[model samples]
Target: MWVCPGEADPELVRAGVALIADERGSVLVDAGQSPSHAREIQAALLAAGLPAPRWLVYTHHHWDHVWGACAWPDVEIVGHASGADLLRAEADRPWSVRYLREEVLRNRRLGPSFRARALAVDSWEELRILPPTRVFTDEVELPTGVLLRHVGGRHAPDSTVVVVPDSEVMLLGDSWYPPPAHLRTPADEPDLALVGRLLDDTIGWYVSSHSAPMTLDDARRAIAG
Candidate 1:
């Protein structure tokens, strides 16, 4: 099942979070934007009668994708090797400490309840960086049939993709998106060749973090035009 804020709300864009489950356990892909977001995810899991995730796989080290990971400190987090380094670097930055507070303030401008619900942090000190427990250079397979691959893209050096062959699902974390003028940049665009190759595979569902999930044919057309 996928857990997301639905549409692009002011507090957060359409960040996608997925839960892949099997008899062995469940894996959560991409922790959401804040602690409250994590709580939302937890509630969804409980409502669905699914077990708490045993593994957390990140697509990249972007703030939105990794910040809420601390909410699941006991889960075995996995991601690209470079992501681990980036997480450590980001945590060391002074601005990182202020991010949650700043976000809460920004949301407050939207509305008080929005601010309270979006961020549950009493102090920035509550925010802590939780690096991946297992970092892989290329690919690794979990017993549940989820494959994590380090598919670097223009978005981030540590961008990864989660593939579930049996389900014909491919979760592309901000790796590929319809080109927009404001976001267009030669240095930070997705790798078309890599995307084309993945699209050519057996994937039926193409899920992205900031956009609605698309069918394989729809993805191909989006890339073509």
Candidate 2:
């Protein structure tokens, strides 16, 4: 798991990134918020004696979970088919550097420290928006026990979950958590059954995109209500 020390602020949701590996190579669950965040992840991998990630599996199309993908030009990225479409659509929109700067300034939830670190971009050109190299509608298995499953919900139409069967861990990217009002659309709605299935005994650890890791029981209780 990748932890950014001194970066947590209650107002903001700090997503946790996970690394899955076997003899073949490493696979990153999320790319992080910026190129700097990707570098931090790279440093963590090096320190752990692991090689650079060969695969990057995104849980969704959120900027926090995908913007860092530009840093790994060679990594084979995988996500839901719709995620690729969304990325393409977003790239076509007016996401200029000035617009992003204004967004950073307007977000009060981002503490000064987080704003400083996440938006340390030198130029708008530095921002990289990449679509998935590989896309799947339901599930796909990699060399390791890694599995990517699409479980769209209110969070986003392209929401996905990464399951590492060997590790008994499931990475839920906003699948259960509600998206912010501005980000939500009229078509979005919760999928309680998906939450229950994800929390089932098959997954021992639940890694949420915006909260601390939760045990199976914790997830069960959280969804019970």
Candidate 3:
């Protein structure tokens, strides 16, 4: 398993991209924030002598996690059913800078912060919003024994986690975080119980999109406190 670290810039949202590979092929955790960011992941893998990804798995439908689908045209994409539905809604929308800036102004769900994150790209010319090619509900195990689970939380309804058993690493994405203030929702809380159930002896490390990888014990502390 290899991880291409994401940017820490609050205005520029690039979530950590992970690669778990075996003899079968590689499975990528998130597509990334933009074409440039996706290509950066590709370059990082190449530099590390890693195999090209065969499957791209989304942790959720947020722009930072799914916008880089266009960069991996040949790879099969897997996303949660509900998250795919949200992406499908914007599949046809133009992803130009003007459109994004306008969306920031008009869409109640989007705000100035959204504008900063959405537009932090090298180039929007190659931008294309492609929905997932394969959608699953609940949990699915890949041929390589990597597990993906739909554990919705306050951060995003379609939040998913990827578990690589051999590596004993779990990709938490943003599932552990609370909802953004702009979202104006108070209904959901972090599903620590469900998260705890997955953190048995098998898993030793947990990686969240925005933070460095944590030991299993550290993860538990973070969630508890």
- What TM-score, to 2 decimals, does candidate 1 have? 0.81
lDDT of 3 by residue, 40-117 (tens): 888888889999888999999988888887898689898899988799887778766778778877875777556755
lDDT of 3: 0.83
Question: lDDT at 175 for candidate 1?
Answer: 73
lDDT of model number 2 = 0.74
Please give each candidate's TM-score: 0.81, 0.83, 0.89
Model 1 Cα lDDT, one tens digit per residue, 66-148? 77788775799998999899899878865433553575466544244234333444345556767788989999998788999
Decreasing TM-score order of the candidates: 3, 2, 1
Please give the clash total of every predicted structure, in order: 0, 0, 0
Relative to the true structure, how large is the alpha-carbon lDDT of every model? 0.74, 0.74, 0.83
Regarding TM-score, does 1 or 2 come out ahead? 2
Q: Which sections of candidate 1 miss by over 4 Å?
A: 5-7, 95-122, 177-193
Instruction: Please rank every candidate by lDDT, starting with the best.
Output: 3, 1, 2
lDDT of 1 at 43: 88
Best by lDDT: 3
Q: How far out, in Å, is residue 26 in model 1?
A: 0.5
